[model samples]
Target: MNDQSEQERWNARYADDSYLFGTSPNAFLASQRHLLASGQRALAVADGEGRNGVWLAEQRLHVTAVDFSPAALAKARRLAESRGVEVSFVQADLATWEWKESSFDVVAAIFIQFADPPLREAIFQGIRRTLAPGGLLLLQGYRPEQIQYGTGGPPHAENMYTAAMLREAFRGFEMVSLVEHDSVIQEGAGHHGVSALVDLVARKRA
Candidate 1:
């Protein structure tokens, strides 16, 4: 689907009075929270409904949540308000967003899927360029094997990720952790129950 169509689809999905992905950080991120540095600027890309972004803000990280859906951004704002935390929301397509270089101390990407190889490469490059020296990146996404689990994730196998894919994407970075595992995700209607996923944490060399 084109960017506009994709945005519209997500907007419609989130337009209802339901929290699609629930109000919590990804299981992998929450598990590794101790490894994250405090008081650093963080960016949450494709942060639909602001769950993870709001959680980051609550952790005292300066946060900016970016997504193409205004509906999702509106819900994100509401979530931030309820949590009594501040998070900057940017409505833009990640494929075209002018990501800044060396600007963020941490970049968190959870469940953001892209089937187009070029677009995926571009997004990964953007993530790499947007990180500050010694910055860290925390990522979690469904693996192709997830189709068997039938829990959640994109229908296209190409949209799914693998540890090898992430290792190749962030080749130059210091890989702190990279693994494919099974875990129970209790997000909401969209993401729930047992899931097959790849999780990674990499740091930019200073």
Candidate 2:
């Protein structure tokens, strides 16, 4: 889809008054508290409605949250304000987002399974290129098995992640943790049910 159409699609998905996903940090992300610290420059990729971004800000990190939908971003701004946190919210399609090299100390990518293979590769590479040396990446997403659950994420199997796929994509990074499991998650109407999940925590080599 073109940028405008993609924007419209996401805007429509987020047009509801309620947050599609809940206003809580993804469980996988919140579990990695040991790696987070005050004053880190964090990027929350595709941070719909600012849950993770606002949580990052609450942790004292300087956060930049990016999403394509204006509706989602508007809700994100309100969420940030309500939480008494400050997050720099940017509306831009990830397909064409200009990712500055070595720009962020931490990157949080939670349930961003909206892309097909080509765009996914670009985003994977972008994450690698934009992370500063020794920076941490906290990523979680559905595995192919999630198609059976149908609780959240796109139905495309190719859009799902595998541990091997992620390891190879982030090969040069120091793998701090990588796990695959099935769990029951409740994050709102968007993601609620048994889920086939994969989590990856990697640190860029200094």
Summed backbone clashes in each candidate are 0, 0
lDDT of 2 at 90: 94
lDDT of 1: 0.89
**In model 1, what is the error at residue 151, expressed in angstroms?**
1.2
Lowest lDDT sum, 10 consecutive residues, model 1, at 113-122
lDDT of each: 0.89, 0.95
Candidate 2 versus truth, CA RMSD in Å, comes to 0.7
Worst 10 residues of 2 by lDDT: 1-10
Give me the runs in candidate 2 sitting further than 4 Å from their true place.
Answer: none
Tell me the lDDT of model 2 at 68: 86
Residues 71-175 of candidate 1 have per-residue lDDT tens digits of: 999999999999999999999888889989999999999988843667788889999999999999999999988888888877778888989889989999999
The true-versus-predicted C-alpha distance at residue 178 of model 1, in Å, is 0.7
lDDT, residue 12, model 1: 95
Q: What local lDDT does model 2 show for residue 183?
A: 99
Those runs of model 1 whose alpha carbons end farther than 4 Å from true positions after fitting are: none
